[model samples]
Target chain A: DQQVKQNSPSLSVQEGRISILNCDYTNSMFDYFLWYKKYPAEGPTFLISISSIKDKNEDGRFTVFLNKSAKHLSLHIVPSQPGDSAVYFCAALGGSQGNLIFGKGTKLSVKP
Target chain B: DAGVTQSPTHLIKTRGQQVTLRCSPKSGHDTVSWYQQALGQGPQFIFQYYEEEERQRGNFPDRFSGHQFPNYSSELNVNALLLGDSALYLCASSYRTGNYGYTFGSGTRLTVV
Candidate 1:
């Protein structure tokens, strides 16, 4: 069973627009959420993360919002640039030691 | 500092063959985790090693085993490989404590035929 899900497989947006990626989870024990970006042939790079205690966290142009009641979370990039085009995977930490469970991932293409 | 480094960028193996993949963690990091990523899918955790012991393991089978050396480097070994085992193997390194985010290696792409 897929504990975390990212329904959108691909998304395209123009430069300077907002790029949003959504993820949902079925497990209630997940308390920490993280986003990772990956390029072709490279391992995923850590992006932003949010703890369950907070509803929102922002870093520069990237922001993450979590809605506990809905069992959903989203990553938003404002004024998205072409360089931001990559596959984004949403991950959650479950259990006490923070073992991570990842979603399928969404490929984002930001066109100039 | 050097980030996580994995060797044998690509490999090809026949069914039932055995293969070993290597990894060296980043500087000052002592924990290593292994993950397998199938095409167009997110990574699946295999197991994690800390202090040369298997600390946590996912739903993988016994055919997949690993060893962490005293130097904090690691090796992942797959025996009796099946075609379904073909995927990108990734190694991530993190510290034992603190909020240190994992640093991943480029990965070793294994193709089992």
Candidate 2:
């Protein structure tokens, strides 16, 4: 069974609009969460992360919100740009190695 | 500084054959981890190497194994490849203390026919 789930497979938004990607997890042991962005034929690059202790973490136009009680998280990109069109992965940080448990990922298409 | 580097950007192998992929960690990083990403799926952890030892592993079969050199470079070996084994193999480097998040390589695209 997958520990992390991104129900939406894709999201489309107009440039300069807001893009929201959501994720959920079944494992309570997950104490930290991260977001990664990937382009074609490239590895995932870390974007932002939030710890279980905080409900939110922000970086530039990207923000990650966590709800520990619901075991859910969301990534928000304000004033989304065309360059943001790519696959976004939601990951939970846990285990002895702190290896990430990733969702299937949601592809965002920001059109001009 | 150079980030994690993986070799053989792409590879092709026959079923039942074996393959080995290599990786060199980022500068000053001492730990290396591998993940497999199938088409349309998230990356799954394979295992991690620290201090030339296998520190942690995922639910992969024994056919999947790895080695970490003293210099923090690593190799992932898979025996008896299957069609399902074809995927983008990613190598990520990090510090043992977890202070630095991982830096990942573009990955090796392996195809089993």
- Cα lDDT of all candidates, in order? 0.93, 0.94
Candidate 1 Cα lDDT to native: 0.93
- For model 1, the stretches where C-alpha displacement exceeds 4 angstroms are B97-100
Kindly list the per-residue Cα lDDT of model 2 for residues A50-82, writing each as its tens digit: 989999999999999998889899999999999
Give DockQ per model, in order. 0.64, 0.71
True contacts kept of 2: 0.66
Q: Which candidate has the top score in lDDT?
A: 2
- Interface RMSD to the true structure, each candidate: 2.1, 1.6
Q: Write the per-residue lDDT of candidate 2 for residues B15-61, one digit (tens) a residue.
A: 99999999999998999999999999999999999989988888899
Tens-place lDDT per residue, model 1, A29-96, is 88899999999989999999999999999999999999999999999999899999999999997654
Candidate 2 lDDT score relative to the true structure: 0.94
Residue B53: error of model 2 in Å? 0.5
